[model samples]
Each structure stands twice: as C-alpha cells, then as structure tokens.
Target: MSDTTTNGAADAAQAPQIKMNVLAQFIRDMSFENILAQKGTGGETQPDVQVQVNLDARKRTPDHQFEVVMKLKVDSKAKGSGDQLFLMELEYGGVFHIENVPDEQIHPFLLIECPRMLFPFVRRIVADVTRDGGFPPLNLETIDFVSLYRNEMMRRQAATVPADDSASA
Candidate 1:
C-alpha cells in the first residue's frame, strides 16, 4: 500500500502542467471600403453579409513564443441588386508564450486556442469598422474553433491524397 501511494504521488509530480500567456496582440493590417457610397447607390436596400476566416501560426524568434494570425474578409452586398455594399479585410496577430504543451499538440493549440484568445478583439474591430464605414454595426457570431481546426485538417488531408486514375478505365 505504501509503495503504491508513493508511485501515485511521483506520477502526479512528473506530469506537465500546461501554461499559456498572450504577450501582445494587434491588428497587422486592415482595410474597409464603402462600395455603396462609391457608386452613389444610396438606397434602403436589404444587405447580405458574408465573412471568411483563415488562420496561420508560426514559431517566432524565441523558442517558446509563437505568432498566430487570423485573417478575416467581410463582404456586404445589396440583396436585390447583388451589388457590393462594402468590403473589409483585416489581419490580426497575437504573440503567445506557451509552455508544457506536447510537441504533437502545439500545432492545434496555436491554431485553435491562441486564436480564441484574440477573437474578442477581432470581433470588436470588425464591428467598429463597419459602423464607421457608414453602415449599421455588424456584430459577428461566436466562432467554433474546434470545428474550424478539424475542417482545416480534413481539407489538408484531402489535398494530399492522390486520386485513383484507374477509375477512368
């Protein structure tokens, strides 16, 4: 009984604890164009908005520090005329200090968890830009990071798999 208890205590002590900190976050680049105003087509038309998100992560100069970038493209068009109302592109980045995560997991951690920490700031900026660009505030819905990560993995896998040419016969 004493040996078992000692082994359990030792196992607990040897387990690594995960730690993560956001060192800094900022908008690397951003642009907002009000196409409606440009075209002088100022009418009370219904607007349809679509947003696309992409993420990238890379190791920085420091061994433990990583940089993660989230790219967002938003386009709004008049529902009836199919004309662009506005277009916004934003690239937001965050520097993170992560420790004790397994090597295999670091990729997912950087892509998923790091972006989650920076998402609120990204959302706020998007809303502010749209409102300032002469449109109503466009609040974004919550994003599912896990689903996004899984989808990206699936996409990459599909790209790498070779198609069977024998099927042409």
Candidate 2:
C-alpha cells in the first residue's frame, strides 16, 4: 500500500467514536402528594410553584456501563393561606452502555447527553401524575443539561480554592 493510503487507514482507525445504548430505563422512585386535598380546590388565586432539579451519574462497577439519575421536586403552596397545596418528587434513571469514549469526554457524555435522552420521559411522567392527582398538569420546562453541568463544574472549582490566605500565614 502507498504511504499516504496507509496513513489514511490508520487515522480512521484512531478517530474518536461514541455511542449511547440504553440497556434499561426505569423510575428509581417517585411520589406525589396533595397535602390540601381535603381542604378543597384552590381558589381564584394561583398558588406559587417552586421547582428544583438535580442530575447525577455513576459508572457501574466492573463494566463500561453507567447509570444516570435525574430528580425533580415540585412544590405548590397556596398564595394566601400558605397551606400546602401539592408536592411531587420524581427520581428517574437509566442504565446506559457507553463504548469507545475517551476518559476526558466520558463525564459530559454521561451527565449531559444521557439525561437528555431521558428528560422527555421524565417530563411526561410528571405531567401525567400531577393531572391524575387532580391538579393542573405540571409540565416542566426543558432543562439545559449542558448549562447545569458547567455550573456544577464552576462551583466545584470555586470550592477547591483556598479561603482567606491572609489568615493562614
């Protein structure tokens, strides 16, 4: 084979390749609570709804697989009474088979891309469960996993910095 042809084949073999295979997807845990059920439906005033979201991922031992979990907590409280209205907490997870990814890129692949694949399903479940519980369906906004991951990295970096060096020496 010519030198140029040989080098072309070698380059192709070394090129980076990535794949996401969902071996299984399931809800690790989920709960919905209507604390004010007996108190009757909310009045003309709309309740304040608060939401918190978290994403975490880990590699399964002795394998190239990983598990990613996304948690969403929604709390709605009456505007005036402050009495509890409804609370929904969901923990959604998926088992992923990742291969041919470099070590430096694995983290983002798991945290950003994996949960991305799972977000729509989780969103649907939240809406359905809330509707079934008698409240208006809660459709969560589309999450930007990339932004979340970057913010987490920034927080971690800040945490590692020494605090108040003047006090040390």
Candidate 3:
C-alpha cells in the first residue's frame, strides 16, 4: 500500500502541467463594402449572410510564444431580391504564450484551442461592423473548433494522396 501511494505521487509529480496565456490580440486587416449603399434600394429587404473561416499559426522568435490568425469572410445578400448587400473581410491575430504541451499536440492546440480563445472577439467585431455598415447587428453562432480542425486535416490528407500516388508511379 505504501509503495502504491509513493508511485502515484511520483507519477503526479512527473506529469507536465499546461500553461497558456493571451499575450496580445489585434486585427491584422479588415475591409467592409456596403453594396446596398452604393446601389439604391427600392423596398425593405431581408438579409441573408454567409460567413467563411480560416485559421493559421506560426512560431515567434521568443520561445514558447506563437502567433495565431483567424481569417473571416462575410458576404450578405437580399433574401428576396438576391441582390448583393455587403461584404466584409477580417484577419484577426493573437499572440499566445504556451508551455508544457506535448509536441504532437501543439499543431491541433494552436489551430483549435488558440482560435477558440479568440472567437468572442471575432464575433464582436463582426456584429459591430455589420451594425455600423447600416445593417442590423449580426451575431455569429459559436464555432466548433474541433470539427473545423478535423475537416481541415481531412482536406489536407485528401489533397496529398493524389500527389503521393503519382510520385510512386
């Protein structure tokens, strides 16, 4: 029993603890074009919006520090008339300090976890930009980062298979 207790303590001591912090966040680029304002509207129109998301990450000069960027493209159209309403593109970036994560997991962690931490800010910016552009505030739904990461991985795998097959032939 004493040996078991000592082994458990040793295991606990040997386990690595994860530490993470958001060092900074900023909008790397942003653009908004209000098409409705450019083209005169005749009557009330309902808005239909579509949003696309992409993520990128890179290591910084400082040890354990990384930069993650979330890119968003939003396009809106009139539901009834099918006329273009507005378009917005934003690149939001965050600087993060992370320690003690296993090397194998760092890729997914940067793509999923880092973006998860920065999502709320991205949502807020989308809402504010839409409202300021003369449309109703557009609230974004919560994104599933894990699903996104999985889909991206699958896409990358699919893209590489053909190249690998060609090389072998």
Candidate 3 Cα errors over 4 Å, as ranges? 1-6
The regions of model 1 sitting more than 4 angstroms off are 1-10, 163-169
Q: Candidate 3 overall Cα lDDT vs. reference?
A: 0.95
Candidate maximizing lDDT: 3
The TM-score-based order of candidates, best leading, equals 3, 1, 2
What does candidate 1's lDDT look like per residue over 1-169, in tens digits?
Answer: 9999999999998998898999999899999999999988796879999999999999999979999999999999989889999999999999999999999999999989998999999999999989998898899998899999999999887766645444554
List candidate 2 segments past 4 Å from native. 1-14, 38-41, 163-169
TM-score of each: 0.90, 0.84, 0.93
Q: Using TM-score as the measure, name the better of candidate 1 and candidate 3.
A: 3
lDDT of 1 at 148: 97
How many clashing pairs per prediction, in order? 0, 0, 0
44-143: candidate 2 lDDT, tens digit per residue:
5577889888898999984789999998899988878777888989999999999988899999889999999999999899999989988888888998
For residues 1-169, write the lDDT of model 3, one tens digit per residue: 9999999999999998899999999999999999998887645688888999999999999999999999999999989888999999999999999999999999999999999999999999999999998888899999999999999999999999999999999
Tell me, by TM-score, which candidate is best.
Answer: 3
lDDT (0-100) at residue 113 of candidate 3? 94
